[model samples]
Target: MSSALEVGDIFRRHGPAYVHAHDGHLGRVERRVMSAIELCRTAALGGHIEGCQACGTVRVAYNSCRNRHCPKCQGAAARDWLEARAGDLLPVPYFHVVFTLPAEIASIAFQNKTIVYAILFRTAAETLRLVAADPKHLGAGIGLIAVLHSWGQTLSYHPHLHCIVPGGGPSSDGTRWIACRPNFFLPFRVLSRLFRRLFLQALRTAFEAGQLQFFGDIAERADPQAFARLLTSAGRQDWVVYAKPPFGGPEQVLAYLSRYTHRVAIANSRLVSIADGKVTFRWRDYRHGRRPRAMTLEVGEFIRRFLLHTVPDGFHRIRHYGFLANGQRAARLAACRVMLAAQVPKAEGRAEPMAKVAPTPRPCPCCGRPMVTIAIWYHGQAPPGGPFWNDST
Candidate 1:
């Protein structure tokens, strides 16, 4: 199902004004995202004409912008990504863990995104590995897949890492599989304390090394005393480290991954309306039992919030750690299966065939005959044969 409301529609209507309003403030990446969303699946990009053989029906399918942040483009990308991960699943329960930064740190992260976000991933993964390997804990080497999300439901900057981990792992000596209690993964209090310490230490080191930048409200933190105060206050607060119950099985794990792995700040379906120059959209108020509510903001504000999540160019948001780390993923996974005495599961969903081979065209809606590409149109170019039927009709 598709929504009558789309992010592109919002962009098409108010984007230019928003751009003009923000002018010098918008970064290069934010401008690129806005441009991509506005032009996606439109004639601004090139497209082809598909004509039905039997009914002589023709339709113009515009090309996608393929921007990672675009809602329409993520569906295909998510499916493709999930298909690739299907083969990596093991016959073991998986746990969902989340590590979030406190508001102070989040403020700092907003200024130093690339460095701080990278540190968050590394420290979170390290905390998990360190805790899990202790004799008092699971005492094994675990595999993890972590994805970063930088926005809350209302598009606020809320940087966090979501980790999917198997319930058990190979022992320290590579001798046997060690599993956690059926109902428990790790003690959240322990995880929280260690994560807080490691993260703050890393932040202090970065600050001292002059690798982190302070801006706007946090600009005063450029002073060592002010920065120390910020760190001390954050260390006193309880960091959030949550661990959800283990998934029922591998299929459930895949289902959860499909939703989160490619999610943007907001999906188009959540958009309710645009009227009187104010855009209204649905958001979840988590503090209030997660009740659904509508929020209306001016066009510029909406675009501003959306741009808060445009990550630095070429920075990776999803990463693997420990046994799932890229260098030894295949070898470690094989060893894991051997420890569990389990057979390698056949690949579940096949990847799309190589793009070098053109796919069979879809049948026409009217005549049920295969449609052929009758013509190709580049950006700003009209159809070769002219309008087949009035699209507005």
Candidate 2:
């Protein structure tokens, strides 16, 4: 078998194939991302070098690719995000909820990404909040962080939102923290039905405003009747709303949140091989027993699969609503901690100390010792001033 491919290597070898195959409007986004990834952290964006005092190693640390879709760039971001969110974790149990749209809607999303995605986030959150607020159910106004992922394990247009919701919410009067029963939360059937209705209604509004486009097999959605029929069919079909078992406590909740937030369509570790110039990787086929298997594709096809997931410009995939809304999170979290602490003997869950966030080192390929950052330029932003073309020094 040939060696496995890191993201950089795949970009170098097969990126052109992706760019060439994608020759239309959507293709432009893919091309831009590819260029950004290739030059990110390089002299192209302008960066400086650093030397390790101990090892006598000199390396050039370029600026990060920074494209949210880039695999190499999201790690440090995920960590920093979790840090600011540290105090938000309460001692209460938390649940992981996922709501997925069918392929029928996914086609519309492909054309109207930012609009449909925003609607998806809105409808999904509303469904959860509405269901949980009912006295017959959880009967509380919950806090949840929702992240939208637009691709399936195989890089298909399978838009879904992943949510980490606290098991309880504050009382309607905001006087005390209300907690859900230990073993149960909202009713999934109710959540699915409501989510389906809200999404279709929002989609219809988007269509009437002429905000949606149609081409290929899905082009007919531009027709009002066709759009209504599509929604009606989807209404009959099950809109999947799955909730994982309750976590042990808030610590487990943050650990879970750290996974979904800031993640792209796929991960580097999942790539297994680039043998004979063919890219091979693993994916979970959720339809058939959720079985795990490997897929091998020629370099061109491989990149096409990867490029299919490049999101629309300025789209915010991670969202917060209800009490977890950004403007109100701090006060709400503080209240949650205080309320939980009063009820449970140990309400302030012991959060794991955050690991240090350090600048990435570019080590010598000759010897894997860490390279140092001798100087920073933005003065604080990133490497500045592209390197000299010819410098032996």
- By lDDT, who's the top model here? 1
Model 2 residue 30 CA deviation (Å) reads 1.9
Q: lDDT per residue, candidate 2, 190-246, as tens digits?
A: 999999899988988888898888988787777889888888898899989998888
Candidate 1 residue lDDT tens string, 179-246: 98897888889999999999999999999999998888878999999999999999999999998778
Q: How far is candidate 1 from the true structure (C-alpha RMSD, Å)?
A: 3.8
Please count the clashing residue pairs in each candidate, in the order shown: 0, 3
State how far residue 390 of model 1 sits from its true place (Å). Answer: 19
**C-alpha lDDT of candidate 2 relative to the true structure:** 0.77
Q: Find the number of clashing residue pairs for candidate 1.
A: 0
TM-score of each: 0.93, 0.86
lDDT of 1 at 99: 99
